[model samples]
Target: MTILENIRGPRDLKVLDEAELDELAEDIREFLIHAVAGTGGHLGPNLGVVELSIALHRVFDSPADRILWDTGHQSYVHKLLTGRQDFSKLRGKGGLSGYPSREESAHDVIENSHASTVLGWADGLAKAHQVLGRDDHVVAVIGDGALTGGMAWEALNNIAAAEDRPLTIVVNDNERSYAPTIGGLAGHLAALRTTDGYERLLAWGKDVLQHTPVIGQPLYGSLHGAKKGFKDTFAPQGMFEDLGLKYVGPVDGHDIAAVESALRRAKRFHGPVLVHCITEKGRGYRHAEQDEADRFHTVGRMAPRTCEPSEPSIGPSWTSVFGDEIAAIGAERPDVVAITAAMLHTVGLTKFAARFPDRVWDVGIAEQHAAVSAAGLATGGLHPVVAVYATFLNRAFDQLLMDVALHRCGVTFVLDRAGVTGVDGPSHNGMWDMSLLQVVPGLRIAAPRDADQLRAQLREAVEVTDAPTVLRFPKEAVGRPQPALDRVGGMDVLHRSDDAGVLLISVGALAPVCLQAAELLEGRGLGCTVVDPRWVKPVDEQLAPLAAAHRVVAVVEDNSRTGGVGSAVGQALRDAGVDVPLRTFGIPEQFLAHGKRGEVLADIGLTPVEIAGRISAALVRVRTKSREEYGR
Candidate 1:
């Protein structure tokens, strides 16, 4: 039998010969090309990490010796070896997650799909291992591009501090992150890729010259004398040793035997060491190699809900709505421009880039720079709409609060994927936007329930001349439109009832659930009113008087139950001396797993049926208390 078919887990991989291992790597690559084409995932990154993953499993005993993936896209190869061979249902509703999921396997250490946080995890795991006297190694496999992030540096500083911190940080030098890696460290890493064993053999040859006869010694010594200057001119890195890391390689990452030797050497080391393995992002696949962008970094929705070709380009996502709306705004206003943190295509701002090539700024994977620069753009009398994913916005929180919100800059923050984004799981979810952004004083946050509202609210946010405004939306479609009833205190009342006992307050794209929940409550004999608090922050003053009028208020939102808009409304009512019992409904604080958005929402009791049931039960208790007090 073949080695691959005989392999059930990492244990089976340990027995393979070098020839079999190389052959197995080819099979995995061919398997990925077909599997990823069918399912459409981060194909290129996984393709690059095939040999690296095999060497990792073959070298380290995993689950005990923790392996953490920085961006997690590269973990697909790691998954395949650890018994996740079924790529047919990958990223499907009930299928395997796009990133490393802790629930999916014991091999996955940290469930991070986001970039640049793996070092911090590595530091923590290594420290934990040291404290508990656990003899296991904590290995963090991070790409070169992940090095650009400030957090990675911060983690590096800490990891460097621990003198004998038994950490093996494998620098997967693909020479790129999303776009090509930037800064001085990228240059340092480039040296590792280019300056192979060419310099080493030269030094060893010079040593042979000294041991030769008198005539030979004269010739050898002259060349050996000039070697320092020559090697200095040739060698690309002087800094890795300065950082106290034992620098090894510029080794061919694609070659399994070379990588296995390097990893085997890294495994025996005591202190922190960096094994630089040079790899091509789209190593084997020609289509991905030619993909001038990020080698199909994150694939857009390929097929329709029916698995047909009519899917309409990832189905006119909320990201597209922002891109088109903002571009239209840019056309209308002469001073308007756009800024994105290395995500022009993902944010759907490619058309803006095409139209106003000079106006659009594609700042490379740097969110902090994007925000602070937007503040500068606004300072120069231009209205800049910073379009970034809500999760990435977390990176620039200090910049947002200090530079933009504190100054009250006329910067429009268009946050796409503003709520529970499913398949990407815990790290990628925009669920915490409400809780965190609420702390930004003078920042107005609006959530559009549909595409139409997204357009209108975006324009309104842009037109507001004095303060910073944010428009948030989910990853999926902007479902059926709801006519705006009233725009009071920056809130849109989607549905209202005169004799309503419950108030359904929604923030952002989850207004559809409020409307549906209202319909269900209507059927359940409880009068309900749904209010889409379009702008979740600044505490809609009108909502207070509305809550004062109602006996019981249940606020339904897609954010966290803690410090969210729902909690704020509950606190607001209590502070205003409104004796109404408020039930704040939101996602409970936990790491949510992979599923369809609808299925995840239903699982968390955010569905219309659950909302209606909770509201109805609240109403029954309140009425029963009223009857007991009045002697009825």
Candidate 2:
């Protein structure tokens, strides 16, 4: 059997000989490269962690011992080793989740994939263990880039304050997070990475300390203290040690022996320890290692053949579409500008950056700053479209509500990946944008069902000068275009059957799904009408009449079921005394696991089959109740 297949858990790794382990590491790398190449996962981060993962598995007893992955994308190798070896179906629907999942395995402690969160999780888990009288060690494997987040600093401070506790913080210094690691931590890590001879000195010191006696004991103590100077002079890790956490390494992370040894050493420390590991992102893969900008950090499907078309087929996304159109507008309008929180590439603003080099700002993973900065730019007479992922936009909720919305700034937010994003797992699904943005006073929210509406709505959003406007779209390509049956106060009637027994109210991506559901209902000789309610914030005036005609009004959205577009419509209809049965079909309030977008939608009962099944059942119940009450 292959080394990967034979390995069941961390204990399986602990027994392997060096040659056997080396062979296993190679097998693991090969498996990862092949798997991720097809699926297009976080290839670079996973590649970097292969040896580190092997070593970690050998050193720690997981399930009992907690190992938190900061920006959990790098946990792919960990997943593979922990008996989740369905590599072919890596990010597919019902496959191994793209990030570490608590449900997927006992090894996964945190499902949060966003950068710089594991430190706080580690701190909390460690504290909880202590309170519960559990002796399990807590290790947080954080990337060098993840350290830039403000919360990581706060956690570091708290971890530092708590002394004589066993907390090992593994800084996986790969020098990248979708892009090269930026800020103070990156520079400090680089200093350590560049240090040569320090490895040999470290090895010699360790060997000498083990063989010492009486004067040898005093010598070992002095030498251990002096080694701090050697590391500080080489790597300057005074920042960690000064915080009262023992800092170790600049160790070669690819060397499983080195990593295992370092981890074992860290186990002896009574207080918190920071073990800095140096590994190459995309270590074994040529395509990823050479490629710049996140090294295919997160990928869509492989690009199609040469296209000589006017518009994109599976085209340049709504993001790219927005980027091109807005850049053209910005070229003519001097006051137009843009901002992205370390996601220029993800949100389709790379072309815009190339055109107006000065106007485009790449603020490193700081969404709060991006929101408020756009507000400032708006106030200074510059129109700014803060293009970002809807998931990341949650990071700037307070700033959007307090800084931009309160001031009534004309800042346009182009939130890409707005709803039920697939593959990337729960942290990435843009399901909360509608519910969260609902509280912002006077804020207009627009969700386009297709490319044409997306382009037009984005243009409209840019022109809004009164309060902030948010345009949301999914991570995938533009959805199906529903032809307008009637235009009534921001909502477009897509379809209305003669009987109209059931009204399928569509929200954003759910438009297509709802329309398909309408078709199923139609086949069953049921009256089903579909309306594409384009803007979610300002309730459509036509909903009252639509609800009155239909026996049941079912609102469908690819968002959280709580206080979402469906709930908003239900409330607006309630205001009109259109007390028809309203059923809100949406995602439940929980972190959805990774899968294909369609699978996730279907799993959450938002697909045509699921939606149809639900509507048919609801209609039957509503009709049955009416008959029981009347008896005329």
Candidate 3:
């Protein structure tokens, strides 16, 4: 049996010898490559942290001593060590989650997949430990890229203030988060990784000075006082020491022994300590190492040997459509600049960046900074298109509300993956964007139905020179265009029955499904009229009048049912005194599990059949209620 096979829990790792641990690391890597090849997941980050994770498991007792992972994608190795070897349906429904899950294991503390949050969690845990008089240690494994976020600095400040707090912050310096980490913090980490001359000198000085006569102790104390100055002159890693936290080595993260030694030293330290460990992003795999763009950060199911996708794409992705259109827009509009939160290629800004290099800006993994900076860019007479994943935009809600929306900046937010977004799990789904943005005044939201609509709405969004505009699209491939039968104000009437009883309002990519639902309702003798509201937000003024003519109105969206386009439409109808029996078909207000997009939709009753059934049932109830009230 393999060394990894023996590792049932954290205790099992402690028993392994040096050679066995080395063998176990190799076994784990092979397992990861094979397992992740079959079921796509975060391959590079997990591959890089094999040794560090093993060392962590050996040194710390998890569940009792919380070992928190920032952005939890790196917790694959952690999961392996904790006896989760079943990778058959990884990131799929009823299988292992891609990120850390509290439901899966007692060892997994926090389920938040968002970056730069582990340090804050560690601080809180440490504070709780002190208050409760518990002896448990809090170790936060944060990536070098996550450090760019303002929250990491905030947590660092708090953790540093409490000098008595026992918190070990292990900086996993793979030098990238999604892509190569940006900003001054990444530069500082790069320096620490390459040059350790000053650290060596300090270590030598401490040993020699302390071993001398009575004057030696005093001299060493004096040198320690000026350590920050000396560090500033050479290393510049005194930032941690200045903040009242003990600074450890820039150790080899791949070397299990070295990492274990560094971790042990940090554990011995009574206060907050940071152990900087350097490792490559895709260490074991040659294909991943050769990937220059993002080091194979995330991947679809691919051949393990060549690293090519297993299956061909069905159609052009929504991102590519946006990419091409944005590039075309950049060519014409000189003032149209682009901004991304460390996800240039991911958000379809790669082509735009390539075409207009000087106009594009990658603001690192700081969404808050990206939103505020877009506001500044707008103020400087440039219309900045902030392209980011819908889920990540949650991080910059305050910035979006205050800096952009409050100022009424003409910054256009292009939200990709703005719907269910299955397989990545709960934290990854973009179901809350519509609900969350509903309250933001002076903000107009556009949910494009097809590739043509996405292109048209994007152009329309940039043209808005006053209020902020958001154009959101789903993760799936762009479907075939459904040409409108007629146009009612800004809404596209896709299907109109002779005697319409139900007005089906389709939001974004769900237009096809809504049309199918309308057909099913028509078959059941309920005449239906389906309309695609190209721009969902500011609840199109034309909808109230259209709904008043119908007996029943239903809004179908890929977002959350509680506060999605459905809720906005309901409010609009209520305000206009259009008392038509309205029903909403959308994702329920709960964390959706990982699965295929279709499977997840079906599970949540977002399918066409389910929608039509619900609408049909509601129509029956409405008709019965009318007869009872009127005494007919």
Candidate 4:
């Protein structure tokens, strides 16, 4: 049997010899390449951390000693070591999640897939351990890219202040998060990687001074007193030392023995200690190493040998449409600029960056900084289009509200993966943007129904130079253009029935599904009028009058149903005194599991057949209530 086959848990790893551990690492990599190529997941990050993860499991006892992973995407190797190696339906419906899950195992602590949050969690856990008088240790494994976030520094400050706290911070320096890490911290880390240790400097002083004259003895005494200044001048290892935390070696992350030694040293230190380990992003795979864009950070189902996609491209994605349109906008408007939070290529800003190199800015993995900086740029007479994944925009909510909306800045937010990005699981699905942005005063949100609408609404969003405007789209391919038969104010009348009983309001990419549901309702002798409100935020003024003309009104969206466009339309009807029975259909207010987009939508009852059936039942109840009122 293979070394990996016999391993059931961390205890299995503890018993392995050096050769057996090396063989186990090879087996795990082979398993990952085959398993992930079939299912698709984070391949590069997990491949890079095989040795580090093995060393960590051997050195620390998890569940008792919390080993927290920042951004959780790098926990694949950890999962393998913890006896959860079943990768058959990984990231599929009722299968292993791409990230860590508390439901799956007791070893997984935090389930948050967002970056830069592990440090704060570690601080809190350590504090709790101290208060409860527990002897367990807290180890936080953070990536170099995650250090760019402001929250990491906040936690670092707190962790450093508590000199009595037992915390081991493992810095996994792969030198990239999505794209290459940016800003001052990245440069500082690069410098640290090339420098020698303080111990080497101390030894060099002893060797050189011992060969000198009688004055060497007197000079050594003065040098000992000024060792702090000497060390700062040569090594500059004072960055962590000044913060009151012990700093360990810049060890080779791939060398299991070296990493284990450093981890053991940090474990002995009672105070906060940091172990810096250097590793490559895609170490074992040649194809991943050749990928310069994102280092194959995330991959789709692919051929293991060639690294090519297993499936062909369906069509032009929503991002490509935005990419072409935004680049054209930059060519015409000299005042136009773009901002991304370390995701230039992911959010389709690459074309814009190529056209206007100086106009585009990558703010690292710091969404809050991206939002606040865009506000500053807007106030400085520039139109900045901040492009980010819809889910990540949640991190900058306070900045978007207080800095951009309150000041009435003309910052246009382009949200890619705006709704139900199913494959990456719940934390990645952009299902909350519409619901969360509802309370932001004067914020106009546009949910485009097709490629044409996405291009047009993007232009409209940039034209607004007073209040904040958001243009959001889903993660799938843009379908064939669905043209409107007519226009009603700001809404598009896709289909109209002679005996209009139900006014179906479609939001964003769900227009096609809404049209299908309308056809199903029409077959049942229920005439329906379908409209796509291109901009869904203010609940278009024309909708209240349209709802009054129909007996029942139904609104469908890909966002959460609680505070989505449907709820906004309901409120609009209430204010206008239109008492038509309304039904809101959308994703329920809960964390959706990982699956194919169609399957997850069907599971949540967002399919056309289910929607039509629900609407039909609601119509029956409404008619019965009307007859009862007449009888009364």
Candidate 5:
């Protein structure tokens, strides 16, 4: 059996010699490369942390000693060390989650796929340990890129507050979060990485000086006594030291022995300690290391040898469509600028950044700052499009509402991966944007049904210079363009029927599904009219009147049923005094499990057949009630 197979738990690692441990690390990497390539989860991030994860497990006892990961995509190595070696179905419906899950194992703590949240979790856990008078250790592993977030500093401020509390913070300085770590914190970490140790300098000086005459010994003694000042002058690690946390080495993260040594020292410290570990992001994989952008941060099913995708492309993804349209828009509108939260490529702002280099800003995992800064940019007489994943937009809702919407700033927010983003799990799903953004008074949302609508709606959104405008789209390929039969006010009439008994409202990518459902209803001897409400919010002026013409109205959205476009339609119909039976179809109010987008949708009854059956039942109930009332 291999060294890795012998290791079932952390206890198995303690008995291994240095050579055996090295073999184990190599075995782990080989397994990851093959397993993750087939399964299509985080490969580079996991490869980078093999040694670090091994060192952490060897130094600290996890489950008992809370080991937390900042963005839990890096926890694959951690998962393996804790007895979960199966990667056959990683990120699939019933398989291992992409991030930490509470249901997975006791070793997995928080499901922290969201970046820069581990420090806060660490602080609270440390406090709880202190309150309970427990000796259990708390170690939080956070990336240098995550440290660039404002919340990390906020948590650090609190972690520094308690001097007696023992907590270990390991800085996994891989230097990228989808892209290179940016802003002042990155520069500071770079300085720390390069700076020579003060202890080494002092020790060298002491050895040479003590060998010399009396004057040399006196001079060495004076410098050594004032070590705090001298150390600050020597190394740039004074940042964490000044924050009331004990500072440990800029150790080689790949060297298992070195990382273990630093972690041991941190564990022994009474107060909160920061252990700076320098490592490469894509450490064992040649292709991942050579990757200039994101270092293969996330990958799909691919051949590990050639690093090519296993399957062919479906077509232009929703992201690519947005990227092309936005780049074209940049040429027409010189006033338009783009902003991304350290994910220029992931959010499809790469072409825009490449074309208009100076006009774009990468805010570095700080979504809150991106929203507020967009407001600032708009006030400065420029229209800024803050593009980010819809799920991450939840972080900056306050900034979007108060800084942009309250002030009536003309900022366009482009939300990619807007709804039912499966595989990455519940936290990564962009299912909450429509529901959350509905309450923002001045914020108008556009859920485009196709590529043509996306382009048109994006241009329309940019044209508005009064308040915040949002253009949201899903993760996968853009479907075939659904041409409008006619236009009813602001809505696109996709399907029109005479003697229509049902009016179907389609939102965003679900237009195709709605059209299919309409066809099924028509076959059932129920005439159906399908309309795509391009702008979901503010409820198009003609929607209420249009709904009144049909016997029953059904609103289908890819977002939550509560407070979504359906809710807005229901409210609009009520206000217009249109007493019509309305049924809303959407994701249930619960955390959906990780799966394929189509699987998740079908599971939630968002398909055509399920929708048609439900609508038919609702229509029958309404007619039956009407007949009873007529008989009365």
Candidate 6:
């Protein structure tokens, strides 16, 4: 068996010698490249963390010690060391989760992949250990990109204030989050990274000066007192040290011995300590290292030899459609500025950023800042498009509501990966944006069905100068344009039957499914009318009247069943005195397991066959209830 196969648990790592450990790290990297190439995962990040993960497991006893990983995509290496080595179906149904999963092992904590949160979890866990008078250590591994978030700083403030807390913070400085980490923190880390021999100089000074006699002790003391100024000249790590946390080395992260030494020192320290380790992303893979973009931050299933995708492209993705259109729009509208929270390329803002460099801003990993900054940009007479993954917008809901909506800022929030992003699991799924944004007054939300609607609705959203607007699209390839049979106010009538009994409301990407369901219903002798509300929020005014004409109304969306477009339509129908029996079809209120988008949707009864059956059953129930009332 190989070294990686031998590492069934953390205890297995402690038995390995220095050379064997180095060999293990190499084995892990090779295994990751081959395994992830077959199953498509976070290839570069995992490859970069191979040594660090091994070093950490060896240094700290996880489960007991509580080694928490921030934004847990980097925990794949951690998982492998902790006995879960099967990568055959990583991120697939009934397989290892893409992020840390508590269900998978006792070693895994903070299952959610949200960034900059591990520090807070570490703080609380450390406090718990302290309160119980237990001796377990708490080590949080956070990326420099995650450090850009406000929450990490907030946790740092509290952690620093408590000088006796036995907490170790490992700053995994890979210098990138999607792209290179930007802003002041990145510069600070860069300064620290460039100070190559600062630690050696300090050690040399202490040894030489202290060995010289009575004058030597005081002289060394004076040098230590002036060390802050001396350090500022070299590393400039006064920011962390000044906060009262013991700052350790800008060590080589890829060097197992150096990283283990630094970690051991941190483990011995009684107070909160920060160990800064600098490493390169995609450290082993040549194609990944050479690639300028995100260093293959996330990869699809591919051939390991050529580093090419296993399957050919289906068509232009929803993101590409949005990217091309946004860049085109930027050319025509000079006042249109864009903002992304460290995900310019991922959120379809690459072209926009390239075309209008001055107008676009990458606001680090701070989603709250993105929302507020967009509000500021809007207040300055420019329409700002804050594009981000829909799930991430949950972090900035307060800002979007109070800062933008309350002030009536004309900010357009473009949410790519809007609904049911399957593989990355529950935290990555963009299923809650519609439900969350439903309560924001004067906030209009558009759910585009196809490439045409995405382009047209995006234009409409930006043109609304008085209120905040949102345009949400899924992560899948953009489908063919579903031409409208007719229009009912702002809604598009996808299919209308001459003797329609069921009025089906389709939201966003589910328009095609709704149309197919309508066809299935027609074969079952139940005529159906399908409508796509281009803008789902505020529920088109004509919907109540239209619903009144049908026997029953059914609203289908790819979001949560609670408080989504379905709920909004129900409320509109009730207020208009229509009293039409409505059945809402959507994702049930539960954390869906990792699977393909179609598989998850079908499991949740979002498929055409499933939807048609449910609607037909609902009609039967309605008829039975009406007959019983007549008998009464």
lDDT of 2 by residue, 1-632 (tens): 78988988888888899999999988988887667656667777888889999888888998788888988888989998898888777778777888888788988988878877889999998899889988889999998877777778889999999876689899998873222223455445443432344445655876777677656667877887875676566554778877777666767788887778678777766668788888888887776777677775764444212112223366456677777777777877778799987778878888888889999998876788888999999999988989888898998999999999999999999888888888888889999999998888999999888877887787888888879999998877664566788876778888878896998888876677778889999898888988887888888787787688789989888789998988888888889989899888998999887888878887888878888888899999999999999986
Whole-model alpha-carbon lDDT for candidate 1: 0.78
TM-score of each: 0.84, 0.84, 0.92, 0.92, 0.92, 0.93
lDDT per residue as tens, model 1, 1-632: 54556667899898888888888988888777777667667878988898999988888899889989998989988988898888887876768888888788999877766778898998998998889999898888988887767778888778777757788888898864223333445445334322435345655776777677786679876775564344334333335644656555656788777677667666766667677788888777776677787875655444312223323544577877778877787777878889987678888888888889899997766789899999999989999989899888988999999999888899998888877887677787888888888888788888778888889888888987678898888888766678878766667778877776787787767777878888898887777777787777778778788877787888877788888888888777778778888888888998787666777888899888888888888889999999999995
The CA lDDT at 461 in model 5 is 99
Clashing pairs in 2: none
lDDT of 5 by residue, 509-583 (tens): 999999999999999999899999899988999998999998999999999999899999999999999999999
Residue-pair clashes per candidate: 1, 0, 0, 0, 0, 0
Candidate 5: lDDT over CA atoms? 0.89
| Global lDDT scores for all candidate models | 0.78, 0.81, 0.89, 0.89, 0.89, 0.89
Task: Tell me the spans in candidate 3 whose CA falls farther than 4 Å from its real position.
Answer: 176-225, 229-236, 629-631
How far is 324's C-alpha from truth in model 4 (Å)? Answer: 1.5
Error of model 1, residue 396, in angstroms: 2.9
- What are the RMSD figures for all models against the true structure? 6.4, 7.2, 5.3, 5.7, 5.9, 5.6
Off by over 4 Å in 4: 176-225, 229-236
Candidate 4, overall lDDT? 0.89
Better of 2 and 5 by TM-score: 5
Per-residue lDDT tens digits of candidate 3, residues 1-632? Answer: 88888788999988889999999989999999989999998999999999999999999999899999998999999999998999999999899999999999999987869989999999999999999999889999999888889899999999999867789999998973222222455445434432346446767988999999889889999878775565555433577777877666567788898788778877866678888888888789999899899888998999999888998888999999999999999999999999998889999998999889999999888999999999999999999999999999999999999999999999999999988889889998998999999999989999998999999999999999898999999898998988999999999989999886889999999998998998898899999999998888898888898999989999999999998889999999999999999899899989998898988999999888999999999999988998999995
Off by over 4 Å in 6: 176-225
Evaluation by lDDT, superior candidate among 1 and 5: 5
